[model samples]
Target: MPTRTASCTCGQLSIEVQGAPTGVGLCHCLACQQRTGSVFAALAGFAAPYQVTGSATEYVRTGDQGAKFIFRFCPVCGTNLFHTEDGITGRVSVAVGAFADPGFPAPQVSVYDCRRHPWVQLPPGAVAFKKDPP
Candidate 1:
């Protein structure tokens, strides 16, 4: 895949990601829902060499598994752009919706299934976990 750009709602912050995503997944954790203000969050992971421009603010929080994560968002628009965990090295989970591309790849995994909305439907063959996979 070629390079793709993702921008915040106000277009004040953006990122240029090269190559294809290493992974794509959906998170149904309450923190994800609260952050995105939606039922869940769709994220695409990219390794190093990605370029981010403009300013962003970060919020750090602990997950159910006792791992800490930093959520980065556009300071101007408050658009959640990406996040990184303490244990995850050299990769970022970008908010798929921020790309504003309908043709973006579908999620390969669905996590925190226990918190997923009852009416939410996932891809037929997606790998799902009741909670974070071990």
Candidate 2:
């Protein structure tokens, strides 16, 4: 597997994913939009038993299902680094845009579609689920 390196836009924070992503998905919830300022947020989840260099700010939040999701990021660039959900993959979801690799595969599924804006058309080829994966 090809290890990948990524950092905050200002390069203040950096991380190395020793292998391929654990998965990828699109989240259309309001929180995701409020965080990314995009129509939706897509992240490349990776199970990297790695270290994070530089200080990061964190926001501990609970999802609709009450799963604790930790939002971690760089304080300098204000980039959203990763998110972790309880009892799922022990890995974090890394923003694909942060990766040096531009050929990042798009989301595999569309989550929180119930909250997706009607103005934005769903991206082709993604399984549109009303809620998160089961």
The TM-scores of all predictions, comma-separated, are 0.95, 0.88
RMSD per candidate (Å) reads 1.1, 1.9
* Clash pairs for candidate 1: none
Expressed as tens digits, the lDDT of each residue in 1-134 for candidate 2 is: 67787789999887777777767788898889999999888888888585688889999878888899888899988998777776776587888788867687767778998988889776578788888878
Candidate 2 colliding pairs, count: 0
Residue 8 lDDT (model 2):
90
Candidate 1, residues 21-65: lDDT per residue as tens digits? 999999999989998999999999998778889988999999987
Q: Residue pairs in steric clash, candidate 2?
A: none
- Which candidate wins on TM-score? 1
- Candidate lDDT values, in order: 0.92, 0.81
Please give the TM-score that candidate 1 achieves against the real structure.
0.95
